[model samples]
Target chain A: MKEDPFAIKVENVSKKFSRNLRRSLFLGTLDLAKSFVNLPPDTTKLRKSEFWSLRNVSFEVKKGEIFGIIGENGSGKSTLLRLIAGIFPPDDGRIVVNGNVGSLIAVGAGFHPHMTGRENIFLNGTILGMSRSEIKAKFDDIVKFADIGDFLDAPVSTYSSGMKVRLGFSIAIHRVPEVLLVDEVLAVGDISFKRKCMERMEDIRKKTSIIFISHDMRQVERICNRVMVIDKGKELYTGETLNAIDFYYKHTIAKEVQNIDPKLIVYESTGDIYNITLNITNEKGENTEIFKHKEKIVFEFNFESRSEYQNPILGLDIVSPEGITITSLKNVIFGHQRPSIKVGHNNFRVILEDNSLMPGTYRIAFKWRKQDNFSLVSATGGRFAIQSEPELVPFGGYFKVKYKWIQN
Target chain B: MEYKTIYTPNQRFKVNIFKTWYIMFRNVYDYRELIFQLFKRDFLMTYKKSFLGIAWILITPLVGIVNWAFLNYTGVLDPGETTIPYPAYVLLSTSIWGLFMGFYVASSNTLNAGAGFIMQVKFPHEALLFKENFQHLVNFTISFVIIITTLMLFGVKFSFLSIFFPLTILPLFFLGSSIGLIVGVINIVAVDIGRVINKLMELLLYVTPVLFASNTENENLQIALKYNPLTYLLGVARDLLIEKNVQNLDIYLIISLVTFLIFLLALRLFYVSEDRVIEKMI
Candidate 1:
């Protein structure tokens, strides 16, 4: 065996599987008979109850690269990983793995319920390719990392699924493999353990190549050096992590935006009557309430007055889900270079060149408060949702800011 | 070991059979510690909740012998008279037959039992089969002690040839495992094959002379036993230790040759098609 620079190189790979047992057996018999005659079965032709899962996939990963694969369920991401892990042969093309691969594809697998957690550590570690002495040396560390405490002596069946996963994950990472295949196994652990796992993964990434598959876009963005987006068994994008995430958001999330009136959350009026309408246009110049992250959005308001009012303040407040007002605009709050407003009809346009709000629904409340302790009309205007591009911090509560960390 | 590029698609890449065998055995050798650990796990897990625990291995075979002895002693089921006592005859045969049967069952179910490990981990899948066989071998060793006690109770004189008794049974283990490996692979896709094999084992127990000596008066039954490999295997094991002479040495040697060939082919087939079989299993 010669030394190879690349850790993983998959070329024009494809996989096909049968849906049921009867057809699988029939196909097996046919393949066996054909093998006797030295005739290769044709992979291009599909028989009944068979379908191709991956088609013509090709990529190469450097020795220390942390590669990420992002796709929805049934997008063939797991199939691709399995092929690369040598779990099965591809129906067509070639996959070259130049180093030892340790997979965390299904955590806590092969754990016997009757065995103690301590015993299972050795069992699972050996399954992941750790030698006996290697496991013996790391036994205490594995227990400490898993944090099962005194329950380590207890049978694995007595432990919860989380505990089993913790033990399994600990043993898998401790193997110090050259190529690691992770498939959504980290999602099973708790928040603190997940953080610890992320740190451990980062440490390992400097020395080992990793192929990560996850639906958690934030996690992928945080650690992956490169990302590949797959949909329905086809490679949609493969390049820089940020660009692949953007490609995924534009196709899957951003395309779901609709041009509909935002729901009114709150409304109260005492005396004065006014009619209001809100409309938003996206960067594409099409009238849409949905806008991508940092995309320019034009918010237009059309209002009509039934009675003449004096010194009325027109205010707009954008409130996040936590009811915190992100930013508010009022004519009196800023230095006044006010536009004249007639009683019959008026149009006010606000163009936000960098609408940097995070990805979530936001309520836009409009209020017309009179000067000197009198209120005209205070009510919710409309709501428009933003679909931000994938970021490292998902579900961070709809607030995106610009800052960097500096340690003292 | 140096890093090498492993291609996925089945290609015209010629596999050196000798090299593949060497690598396969080398992997098994390297993972020997793992094999022992797995065997211990299976051994402990099988009797984990039971009060008897390890004693059950011996107790189970003892109960079988007692039940068969009672029937034979009552003359309700006459195993043709042997030079040795009937209880000793039944006891020895049952233990030997049980060992072979255990290998067959373990071999056939090893892959299915380790399906979870197969799907999630990348290790020598053959090691699991070896672990299963090892577990059964331990069980058989424990039960073999009861056979020795029965031999002394029947006042049977053992010859020096009894030292080779354990070595003789080794071929029978391989013969059962050869069939096990082939049937196990087939069972992964066609599960009914395993069920059929299980039923055939029951029928085979009656056909083989495990519970009785060969009755040449019944020509039809004798002819069937003559062709059955187990008949020659069990005959050699029993006569060498008890009767002090193997009746069918020529036939036993011929069967041993065939068993060795079958084992080689079975192992080759398993190693070659393991990945494809696992894909379907998934």
Candidate 2:
């Protein structure tokens, strides 16, 4: 059996952040009183108010592994990073790091505006645990990597945002700690610089363990050997990158669908009195088939009515898995009016031409009502998955348009 | 791989003062380059954007001297039995007092000002305080030079006592640093202390004999001033600069030794608590 290679072990870690200000104040007063009374500080008591940001977050990253933490905003991913970096001590539980750690939670965090870049370099390097001689040795490399040549001598306040970040990143990576904690800083640099930073991170990852927190799932998938999803401060899943991302999307989609009120369902009215059947159709008009990216699709609603309402309106909307309205279509643009349904059954079909959307699962939503008053009479929705043909196009999004290729 | 382990998994709490001191000193020495870097940055940045540039150092002490001269001329502060000119007296007192004030302010606010460094980076945070304190040392040195130059220009008598200026600042630095370390620690654990210290320092300026010489006849105030370490520091500076060799050497020696010990104790406490306290607060 292979031995576990993890250098850092976080066991049953839970962190709480109190949202209540009054509770915090009360607890602070009590702690003050206790200290004055010469009593030992009670570490376990929350006093009056506290909430856990992370609950039973347990995971292990082997030495020299690149681990990604993926979550939406307010997911407590950053809090975990801070805890591991020792910026904030854990309210409970233990995190044991076998070696030195470096964190770049925010670039240029300590750079004084009035001080020059060269001056800040020494300050920043020392803050990252580098001695003067060590910084001096790496001075040339830092300057070269920052690429802010003559501006290094100028005050850092004069440097642009990119320049400052570059200088900061250069110093941080040069520290060469055993563990590196990075938080969303990769998104700040330009394309070339970002690529360079990624390359540097890859090189560093071979020798150091890294915990990278990012919202960009693609980037996480690209570099991380493993991934963890945090939701509401709890570990939703942790495993391989692809599996974690798939679980995240599934969980998010289910949560969103459950949150939507079922009573908002719309139904056809003022038409032939017949049962309306809503069927999701692909670009080829095939039923029960997953749609392909950039393929034509349609929501064919079949109904029978005794009489048709004049100037009726029909609409369809496609919602992303995350509940964001991706696209909406209406019959008004097609120069079609809601024909009066005689006292019989009728069929209504809303066609979506050239659905040029990225390859992702989406939900089909339908709405129908009389043209006037526009009261939502009936609505029904269902999910659809779009599968991209990688052979036809590169493995990115589905909306690849025609363009002239020229070489000078 | 059979091995006999002497250390247990959960060890009892041990307080090793010598080991802690060793670690603190080693860390400071390792990061000493940062000290000079911060000092240079602070010293240069202060004068960089100013139109008057380095002249502000000279102008500051000059302002103190002029303020005292005007106050004395209007009989706001009675010139004591000492025959020293009021401007000279104020310059000597204010320059040394300025050093103490500068060190105190810098040290007191070191953690607050360097919170950016504390929260985002993993370094020995005490170095930030030391770096700020050292920068004030540089500023004091620069201001002292200006004071000495002005005295020479005014044709004030220069004697062997002038050599003691450096020695005088050593005791004053230790004294200021002790107060600063204590205040810095308190400010980190209890933020309200910072505001209170600032207000108290302002009030203390009047009570501390920075401008007027103490009259030996006023036994009560004199005794009270004697207990104030800052008074001893300022007096030593004045005696060395204005009174020449007529200063009391025995008093200076006793105060210096005592202040040094206090400073060492404060710094030791600061080092032990700096890492854990900063993490908790920020």
TM-score of each: 0.81, 0.76
lDDT of 1 by residue, B1-282 (tens): 547657655542246657657767887798888788778777888888899887788787678667756765686655447877666777788778888888888888768767777877767777877888888888888778776775576476766777788877777888888778767877776667668987898689877887778754688888899889999888788777778677888989889888888777667666665545667777
A136 Cα displacement, candidate 1 (Å)? 2.0
- lDDT (CA) for every model shown? 0.77, 0.70
Q: In candidate 2, how many clashes are counted?
A: 20
Off by over 4 Å in 2: A1-4, A14-16, A20-40, A114-123, A131-155, A254-313, A319-408, B1-15, B67-80, B216-223, B244-254, B272-282
Best by TM-score: 1
Docking class of 2: incorrect
lDDT of 2 by residue, A1-408 (tens): 454477567777776656765455445444444433334344444544576778878888788999999887788998888878876556567777757788889887767788888888987887677778889999999989888989999989899999999999999888777789999998897888888888898998877889999877777877899889999999989998877876766566445445444332445544334466677777567874356556677777767665556766667778775667767786665655445444465676777776677655667666666657565355656666655443432234435556787999
Candidate 2 reference-contact recovery: 0.27
Q: What share of the true interface contacts does each candidate keep?
A: 0.60, 0.27
The docking quality of candidate 1, as DockQ, is: 0.40
DockQ of each: 0.40, 0.21
Model 2 iRMSD vs. native? 6.6
